[model samples]
Target: MSYFLLFVLAGFIAQLVDGAIGMAYGIINTTLLLSLGIPPVVASASIHVAEVFTTGISGLSHAFFKNIHRQLLIYLAVPGVVGAVTGAFVLAHLSERFAKTCIVIYLTLMGLFILYKAIRMKSTAKAAVTFKKSRIIPLGLLGGFFDVAAGGGWGPIVTPSLIASGIEPRYAVGSTNFAEFFVALFSTIVFILILGISVTSWQIFVGLLVGGAIAAPLSAYVARSIPRKIFTFIIAIAVILLSLRMMVKLIFF
Candidate 1:
């Protein structure tokens, strides 16, 4: 019961960040799960599975608001699923501690990258709407791989990169969230085949589902008011702090 509430809170916060800054749902939620002693593979599988439901709500919310990029969604979905499946399968065979460390490191770097985007990069919003649909193949492949590898990345890697390259925030967030649904759905199937589903914590799964669903519409509402840089900074700080906590625990214990 206590854990259920805890995960609900985690999911709310995770989705808020993802909705606002276009990233961090998987990394944030998985960090909490890992801290609770969940195995690395189990953590990723559970997160990806839970994300399918959450992302569906998010995608719809974004779509209704016309936040998605049609071409970008096309570029991301197919390769994203392929990479997600491969990553899930590979994760199933990895050593827990090693995978945990790698995930934490990956998250830490993502946070820092967010900061770089916020502080260093100039806004390209003037031309952001007509971004060049460049490098979709390699970017989608690698983004999908790292997303499941760390239990999240499609947004962190793809969103800022697209934004920096002149894609607008709403489109980046919406399309990525939309594409994440398919990536998570397919990756979840792969995880079930490779690792089975008996290990997942249903209590936490339900908690995340409900919490994320609640946050979905709220995030879209909040996003309309907040500037993209401000949201990115908030996400960067949250992820950096959580990632440091995970790293500290691993190192000291």
Candidate 2:
């Protein structure tokens, strides 16, 4: 297949998983681009450019479906933008190898915790709990920073953290996904200033944008329709599998 069509397929599949479970869009696409010999900086910049559109559409779709927590979205997004800009600067100056390795390890532990919770919880009881500003603000900052520093960590860090803290899985996924759009946008702008917009290929940018946009609404509906127990299991499995994959790549490749 042509590279354009290849990226379109990658984007569709990645966004389908990402919109439902709240992670992997950037990890998937960036890996694919790198394997095809795109430089790390260019691949990351291109994916973020595409995400500016895909994530916006996905966020809006989640909102229309009543899946988002508006307050949570705001709390995550503002700090997330600040963190993303800082991360972009860091990316230009430092190697991401150590940061990515640390994050993958953390994701593995979180996956296990989520798996334990899925098994032990008897019912899909969602508590109407008020989130503390202290926990969420730090989480947003960390998620945003690693998202740029490690090539996509917002959902991996934020969504599972929210769910582990007793937020409903749907709301956690939706809010995190929405917050990521701002993070991606600001990070892309910083990357452009540092590395130039020409780093990204137009074909990769347009393909990922179109394909992710197509999948966004359908994925939102999937998030809304899935049973809570089943959804939790899916998220747990996805997190574990993706984390393990990253770990293998980090250690072996």
Candidate 3:
């Protein structure tokens, strides 16, 4: 009962951050579950399952707030589903150490890139790097793959890249959160096939689902209401801190 309530709190906090900034729910949830002695693959599987509900609610909230870019959401969703299925298969059969390392490095670099862009967004400089639509396919693929393989990375990989490409922070966040629903659904399906749908603790699932559901609309409101400059800075700092934290955990823990 205590752990269940703790997970409720964890889920609320994780979803709050994820909904507002477009990342970290999986990382946060999975870390807590792992500390409770769940296996890595199972932890990832459980979180993805829980995400099915959270992301769905979150997607609807973003839509309600008019934060999503429809075309961008479509482009991200299809390839992301494909990549997530593939990643789920790979995680079931293979070692993810190398893949996780590469993803962590990529996240760190992207975080820095976003921080630079945030700085530029604050300045009067006309210099900008536009994000080409052509990049969406590959970005979706990679983002989906690493998200499952590393336990949580879709927002970390996709949102900042989109924002750096000069997309508005709100749309990037909203679309990414929306697309993640599909990614999580497909990934959860694949995991259920391979790992059979039982989480280490039912509490983890229910707590996260209920809590995340509660936060979904509120976080979407945050994304919609926050100033672009502040939102961008928050994203930059979140990515940097999350990537660095992942680095430290990977090396020391």
Best by TM-score: 2
Give the clash count for model 3: 0
Candidate 2: regions farther than 4 A off: 34-42, 127-129, 194-199
Clashing pairs in 2: none
Model 3, span 1-253: residue lDDT tens: 5877877877888899999999989878877778877678666656777899999999999999999988889889999999888887788665666777787898788889888877778644332324566898888998998888766689999999888777888899999999999999888877777657556657678988988999999999999998777788899899889889888878997
Instruction: Kindly indicate the candidate among 1 and 3 with the higher TM-score.
Output: 3
Better of 1 and 3 by lDDT: 3
Clashing pairs in 1: none
Q: Flag regions of model 1 displaced more than 4 Å.
A: 34-44, 92-127, 194-199, 228-253
Candidate 2 per-residue lDDT over residues 1-253, each given as its tens digit: 8888888887888888899999889878877778888788767667878898999999999999998998899999999999988887788676788888888888899989988888887675664447988889989999999988877789998988888787888898899999999998888878777656554478888888888999999999999988777788888888888889888888898
- 40 in model 1: Cα distance from truth in Å? 5.7
Which is the winner by lDDT between candidate 1 and candidate 2? 2
> What's the ranking of the predictions by lDDT, best on top?
2, 3, 1
